[model samples]
Target: MNTKTPAGTEQITVSNITIDIVRKDIKNIHLAVYPPMGRVRIAAPFLVKDDAIRLFAISKLSWIRRQQRQFAGQERLPPREYKERESHYYQGKRYLLHIVEAEGWPKVILKNKTWIELYVRPGTTLEKRHALMTRWYRTQLKKQIPALIEKWEQIMDVQVNGWQVRQMKTRWGSCNPDQKKIRLNLELVKKPASCLEYIIVHEMVHLLERHHNEVFLAYMDRFLPHWRQLKAELNKLPVRHEEWGY
Candidate 1:
């Protein structure tokens, strides 16, 4: 926790504890406890009073402790830079990157059924290389989305009106039951195919159960028993480096 008092809100600190009060574009105060350690965070609307926020945190102390414990057991991957011999996951398979330089635009191709074709200059900066690779990933996801939607529609008996992929900063996927649409993070293409399938199934189940209550978990377990493992692995993997919103 890092306490910072912005212009609108006030900050408070207690020993190792730090709290930041800032304005946000939301209706409620959201408190979070992140992993690898029991770091606490609170986000309150600009108009929320300091006393009210303090009371909320005090009331949720037990819940926050439980969240910290969950995070403590979860694994976190180190930061990555697009470098030679770097490992990447695709559809539950790990592939070593083989960078090759060419005269034309960069292109990726599978090589020897063991490695990946990442056509880029050796001198290319990690950021640019990552961008190009991410773009290709989005393309691959686009090619697969339609078939996946159809495959799942029959298996889960749920119809999707539309689906789209984007560079989401935080969550892997989101579902809108009213519109029968699901938006998936393009980064999911980098993970195992089973992970994507789990997400698809998870979102589709939301069509029947709107919230993550007992019914939702039961439906998920009935449809995808190994979903919990996939979710745990997904959380351990490195995510895109971008600002996230709750």
Candidate 2:
């Protein structure tokens, strides 16, 4: 039986690798390696013993090191300043930002397939500009998401009660299996459409199998045969600069 204890966080070292451990009222141990630094964390059931967790960590030492190395070598974009001529991505294409000062209503548009025209009032502050761009990204992502959800629902025979877009720092997407709801990271708008579909399918698959265990992987493989390739492509894309917190 799973313990209903409140979550607690602590750390342990195995073979010189520090692993963050969080004990929660969960059924199975969930291990994850987060990006931008490949920080390793394990969310285990409260009843699981520390010795077991340490053994698990020791077994995954090589995988942890590989993930850390991948993160260390991945390309990262510099901080966005929302200024003219700055490079930005949309649908896997790079375009220069073209700032246009206008009288009313800030809007974003694409011009000649080479520029992202961001129209704002004169002397707009950096924060406002960033917010405007984020809203635009959100709008664009929302437009594309429903169609993908509809497509996957029929194919996977799953019902998504609801979906939302959020600016997440650590995860690409997450799902509430019991609620049949999924939340996608707003940053996905900047990636290729295939990547977006991949994330949607991944989250939707969680509705069939809650944990990332063997059954979950089998479902993923059956539903999306080329999922591994898409996952690699998504991970290789340049991520935006942000102050990440554990």
Candidate 3:
């Protein structure tokens, strides 16, 4: 079996398009088009040369451009200071943030799904307020995962050992077939519910097929025929505001 080790990171330019190449002890090179922006990443076996990786990226230039164009049209969330009256998204819907100060720990409540009431102690630091918001987001995302996992497990006839919600910079979700584990981006909670469901199903499908190869595509098509539409819709929404290393 191939050994597991920390992956190496490198930057390469192919036809004026930059690609981040991650070197891992794997059998084949896997290319991923990430969202918020279509940053391309290639996970390749350690023996592969930078030149070979460049050539591979060059070969997929058209597909890369298409994915980038898609991201270019999507809306982008601006840097948030967690102030009152600011816009926030949950499950694909928009809500105005309403902050109320009290002498206790912070809390978040949805006001009729149209507004988010953030209760924070007076004189709370900006970082603390942001943390409260992030914690709320994590809780919301976590609540949605179980039902989706159970539903997909039945449909896909596969069971994941566990799944987690986390702050992810690159992909929305990933699955490790060996460990039967799945991880989803916590930022996904800000998007539409359909988008979140799409990601959950997408990762679950990975249990059946590891690579985003034709077989994987076929499985996605067979199980979630509307996956392409859902993916497009998800990509069309505003990506979370983060300082991404591209």
Candidate 4:
């Protein structure tokens, strides 16, 4: 499809990687690798030339390629059938799902760290079963948020107005520092608890600095010294399967 270009944005391929360059009136060049498919982007000063941008990308060629490779190799959980013997995750631990049909309320319980027993009434529909499991995950994840937020708010000396969990396609967490609110991705309920806390701390730091610039990272370093490691671990976890819309 043909589309009109934004006033100063252009697309070019460099070092076998497609780079989207947006020219802005800025003091410095910024390069980023975004997720889902690891799209590379460069924000450059309005006067910068394509050749200079190519050279910059070339300098970071190895790093860019490595990031792309990691994205390409990221694993995904097959669509859930909500059937017996399927694998599921909680707190980064894998468990086989065991569906148990019974007479009472629907629930999910981890039995002996090896299996997740999902108790439901007979003849539940697929969507209802999925909702039951999703609700259980949300309940478990919510239980930990209050303590984590409280701990960080005191340590960071920041007040959070509110927080919630929801399905997000591309972000694990986001902060609205203006409103002092945080939103954590529900998918995070499947990752390690440490990873969850790491995201919380990262978002809370936005209260101090909004941009992911040097100041923001410095704050992260001060509060969570091992934040880089935690980020790596979180990224290493399998990403959720998303329905791509082109």
Over all chains combined, what TM-score does candidate 3 have?
Answer: 0.78
Index of the highest-lDDT prediction = 2
Ranking of predictions according to lDDT: 2, 4, 3, 1
lDDT measured at residue 202 in model 3 versus the true structure, 0 to 100 = 84
The predictions' CA RMSDs to the true structure, in order, are 6.2, 4.0, 5.0, 3.5
Tens-digit lDDT track for model 4 on 47-144?
98778888888898888888878877877777899999999989998899999999998888889688999998999999999999999999999999
Pairwise TM-score winner, candidates 3 and 4: 4
Single out the weakest 10-residue window by summed lDDT for candidate 1. Answer: 237-246
Tens digit of per-residue lDDT, candidate 2, span 126-204: 9999999999999999999999999999999999999999989878899999999999999899999999999999999
From the highest TM-score down, the ranking of the candidates is 4, 2, 3, 1
Best by TM-score: 4
Clash count list over all predictions? 3, 0, 2, 0
Q: Is candidate 2 or candidate 3 better by lDDT?
A: 2
lDDT of 1 by residue, 80-100 (tens): 676667777666567888888
Error of 4 at 31 (Å): 3.8
Q: Give the TM-score of candidate 4.
A: 0.87
Native-referenced Cα lDDT, model 4: 0.84
**Consecutive 10-residue window with the lowest summed lDDT within model 3:** 1-10
Residue pairs whose backbone atoms clash in candidate 1: 91-192, 91-193, 92-192
Model 2 accuracy (lDDT, Cα): 0.86
Worst 10 residues of 2 by lDDT: 1-10
